[model samples]
Target: MRWWQCRLAAAVALLAAVLALGAAGPRSPAPLRFAPGGRFKLALFADLHYGENAWTDWGPAQDDASDRVMAAVLDAENPDFVVYLGDLVTANNVPVANASLYWDRAISPARRRGVPWSTVFGNHDDMPFEWPPEWFSPAGVPPVHCPPAASAMPEPDPGCIFRGTPRVELMTAELDRACGLSRSSVGPRELWPGVSNYVLQVLSHEKPHDPALLMYFLDSGGGSYPEVVSCAQVTWFHSQSRFLNPDGRIPELVFWHVPSTAYVKVAPKATSEVRKPCVGSLNEEDVAPQVAEWGMMDALAHRPSVKAIFVGHNHGLDWCCPYEKLWLCFARHTGHGGYGDWPRGARIVEVAEKKHFSVNSWIRMENGSTHSHVTLSSARFS
Candidate 1:
């Protein structure tokens, strides 16, 4: 073959290869926008401390009533999905049989609805004491003593660290048993398995064009259970953010059992004898640090991808937007199904493709007799 013929053939082969490569290149994701007149809704209920003895006055009947109410509400709403924020059952000193029963009843409604549901660990659900700590207790360790009263503790215990008020002692003991931790001390491992605190990335089947939403469910076991999320969780979070290719976007939602931060009131000094606010009292401006150790607030504060944080435990209606751009919502508890002045309630949230959404909360009154609804709309985002 001639030299010119060989060179021409080589050039043609290279050109063909380049064209094929171009055709296989990745395509840009479509811009997410809410379908005009398209309504997407999901029901959210938390703190459904279901089980025997959960309520003071009623037992099985109350449980059944609560379950009925929840089922009825879901049927009425016909939402796309249901999310139980946590505290599915109250585990304090309760037998595993009771816990299982309550959980069965509580979840029955969602199951009957045949809708998908997901959960994050709440202080009550899956925390050590919900089950017998003996099963989880380390061999050769002596059981820790439960303090008698709040005054006996040397320091202020957040969430009743000592004396186990409102059954904290019993819960702590159970947690100790579950984690196979030495009763001599409770640490992080017994509470959060795998990494202490970690993020779960959920890709939306509905909105494939949007970035995968990351839900960072922190293990706020507090003094009751060992700190599960350690420095590693924080470090991994930072690293993950760096390489995240949400198609140039951030997570659309974040779900955790505890609030990123909370506000507490501090006392003013009276002429000289200054006293800090009483321990255990809610502070107006205090924010609970993430990981229970070290500072990750700065990392979360700077992450623009985080759209909103959903938390449960307060069992009341509250909203906080600490950062000008972020939204914090507290979901109401579903356990009030039996007792308590607080009505049993749940939230329904609608998310749009354009980063716009609306939240509506429903409360069951007269012991699941009727439901009252409240709706809140977010300032549109893109």
Candidate 2:
């Protein structure tokens, strides 16, 4: 067999092993429980752009850095839960099936450390092959097996450059298999439009049904679609929040890959416009118009229970600024695959088991320095 065939075979064998292990019934993750004093620490790892130069030394080395960051954070914080804020891998250079390897490696640190974690999709997570097939041809012509009409279909044709299973599907499957207790068995039923929109409840006490905090994970519709949090998703969020808390009183923190448009206005000067103390680099980029504001911002503003929004798209910017009645924040880019040579780190948010349901958050670098500690809540922001 040829080199690509060999790689594919190896990847397939590895994937089969993973599936078998998942089927063999590994112990489900225990429910998230806080330490004494009703305090739970959660770590946010972002932009772990694994697979920069797949099947090469540099790419694997970059992933090693991500592993080190995760291991270091897990050791230091002993967090109750962990959240990977997307851009989990740069799979453009690898086969779609082998993409799961990167995901597997990215979450290994957390899994080994015995921490329950979740993920959100970033823009680059499900990208197509880096170079079109024609680039490899002596004649520079795309394969003509599929007709032009195939391009208009919802799924890419086998002959198309973008043809392959999306990395997001593999992601959700792996997460559910590895950390069953952290996610719902039903997997975001018809109520949510996207794959990753699900919730993890932090109980006020040991009772599984009594929820004190609700952690939401959203896909942000990146990769195949425009990177926007859809209106349907916003409605679903409202409905879920109400179903969970009929009195509309539970505290929530939302996590996703891309930031909403509000970040642009709040940090036009690379720093917060408000009087709040924001930290880390403000180096912001032009917000993608497709992803800019839909009604998600409005929904968040109107829902006073959502204490803050945490994201990880723009690797350069890491600030927690006030946008309307919510705190718009970015996770410090933790992977070395993408751009930026700034000191790498992860964001940490702590929720105390208190009556007020306030949150204390900050950033912790690989070297162990911390900054940008802040408290957020609708009452405080309002």
Candidate 3:
């Protein structure tokens, strides 16, 4: 039998064993790889805004709808990995002390299916609590409750209500969960206040040992801090790329929540005919960028190996347009919580395990319809 056939059989048998055992909880992640046919699929669940208004039926209902969307996508695509592409919860709206509870629910579908996953923080993930205006009204619930879970808050809101879970604590909780496949990291100390900055390697289906792809996650700051990828983060990226891919051979893809100013640079004008080269159905809002661009884009632009940057801030936009050497793409809004009545869905990325790989992405709607396909590669442009 051929080597690929052997790998396929092994993967199938392992999956069968896992099904027999049942997904009581996370099983250990086998080594990450594309399917034996040299294809790998990744599902991106973005702007879930999971914990919004937990006290209200509307909030929980939205979460349930989001859960259905994810379950549908997972069943349809059967991705190799999953990425919670930011805004896991609207922390300002989340009354709970530990927001990780909501964050955990956001990635639960992938966990049950035994797919490895990771996350990056969005502006809402750790925003300080904003009291409901109704609380100050005559018919309001008294604003006397203090969060029992949040501790050592560096800065608190007016009432000393829970400041949302800091990035460190959120990422740390996932690491502690023993979820087995949560590749989320708190990132480097030098880049403090910017947790969720880390990298993950997806091994080649052929070599099985060598990393064929490098996926980098950066903390594009928001919430309490300005929504900017700091110069320090750029420096860190330079160091990591130098050490990991000095030759710029392996392909790299980046993930964060907010778009950099570079996105605004390439965005198709919001008003006019709104046609492609940029292929997306919706363009509801202008690019909501970080407060500043302090060199992260330049660094990625200079690197030929950097194929694309995936982000999730704009629920209205889900298109991949070229930005210098790479593509700037917005993941489709996956949660019903965010400000969109449009169809809920996840963005799926597929990569080929070839010497010169092409990364393709499309939006898979909750109704099981897929659209907006684009290839993020120089060859496509050529």
Candidate 4:
């Protein structure tokens, strides 16, 4: 064939392959938007903690429990968009070169349901593994039975490497999935090392021409780096919000894995019971916040458009309290692998299509129980 014909043929083959991938998977909806009834529902799954203790029977059982939790919440809420609010895997406990396998499993529920989703990194997401004393002691390590590896191995042998996967690799792999609706992205190169510092818009159902809401996902650094939102993120927020919502009329919400110091400030007293104005079921532990406050909260507080912020680091706390001009909320523990005896559940956020509407949130537990309903008005924020 001629050079031009050859190039055209190659392009056709590539398109065909892509189409095949899409056809092989579940059908997906259009880019995120409110339903025809002018309402958007979002479900937040936090601290899934997959890939923990793969060598033990109990570990896989816990992962199975986590899967059931996700499946139940997804079916119960049927969120238009889902956010894997981080700690999707206990990287330190994961004895593999790539934690993406667990990450993929964590997101599988949404993918199977054809729901769009996003993710942010948590401290446990990229933590390096610490050698267990038991492995070096009398207890022999279980030989990795994963195909190609020897059925039996010595104690000193490095059967698996758990150095942790980079944020870039995970993000790129998710984006490259077949017909996936993953909105996750590694933001500007300036924020290198901090992936998922991007913004998303939820379009209006009735007026498709305009955006109904603005959502910002930032990398609240953790694991390999200090648990704090860098100054660069604050600057990026101002720049992006200014350019996106010039007049600051559109309502905005923020999502990150680790809770900012502002959460501590707004947190209900550790000993006090959760009440109205503030709403949630569990308050068993104190606020496990970021390392320090680096002006991100100040920037958000100053922005009249920012209505609320969502975080998921403390599995035992799942409350939302008014902070400055916006609300600070924590998603419920949605995994069996984390450090909590609390029941698994997910936080649900719903917004109306109107420019001015109320933002309502509640927790949907695995056993079909829903509680801790709270509302934030867009007009009040405006």
Stretches > 4 Å off in candidate 3: 1-30, 142-161, 271-274, 380-382
Candidate 2 Cα lDDT to native: 0.72
Q: Per-residue lDDT for 1-382 in model 3, tens only?
A: 9999999999999999888789566555566776788878889999999878776778889989989999999999999889998899999988776787787778778888888899998999999878889877988864343344434446654443355778888887777763688888889999978998998888888888888889999988888688999999999999999998899988899999999999999898874444667777778789999999899999999999999999998988888888776888999999999797988888999999776687888999999999888887764463
Q: Give the TM-score of candidate 1.
A: 0.56
The parts of candidate 2 lying over 4 Å away from their true place are: 1-29, 132-164, 176-193, 206-209, 271-277, 281-292
Highest TM-score: give the candidate number: 4
Q: How much does each candidate deviate from the true structure in C-alpha RMSD? A: 16.0, 10.8, 9.2, 5.4
Estimate, for each residue in 287-330, the C-alpha lDDT of model 4 and write its tens digit. 98888888999999888888899999998899988876788999
- Please state the error at residue 185 of candidate 3 in Å: 0.6
Residue range with the least summed lDDT across 10 consecutive positions in model 1 = 274-283
Query: Which residue runs of candidate 4 sit more than 4 Å off their true CA positions?
Result: 1-29, 144-159, 378-382
The lDDT of each candidate is 0.48, 0.72, 0.85, 0.85
Residue 56 in model 2: shift from native, Å? 4.0
How many angstroms is residue 218 displaced in model 3 relative to the true structure, after the best TM-score fit? 0.4
For model 3, where is the 10-residue window of minimal lDDT?
142-151
Better of 1 and 2 by TM-score: 2
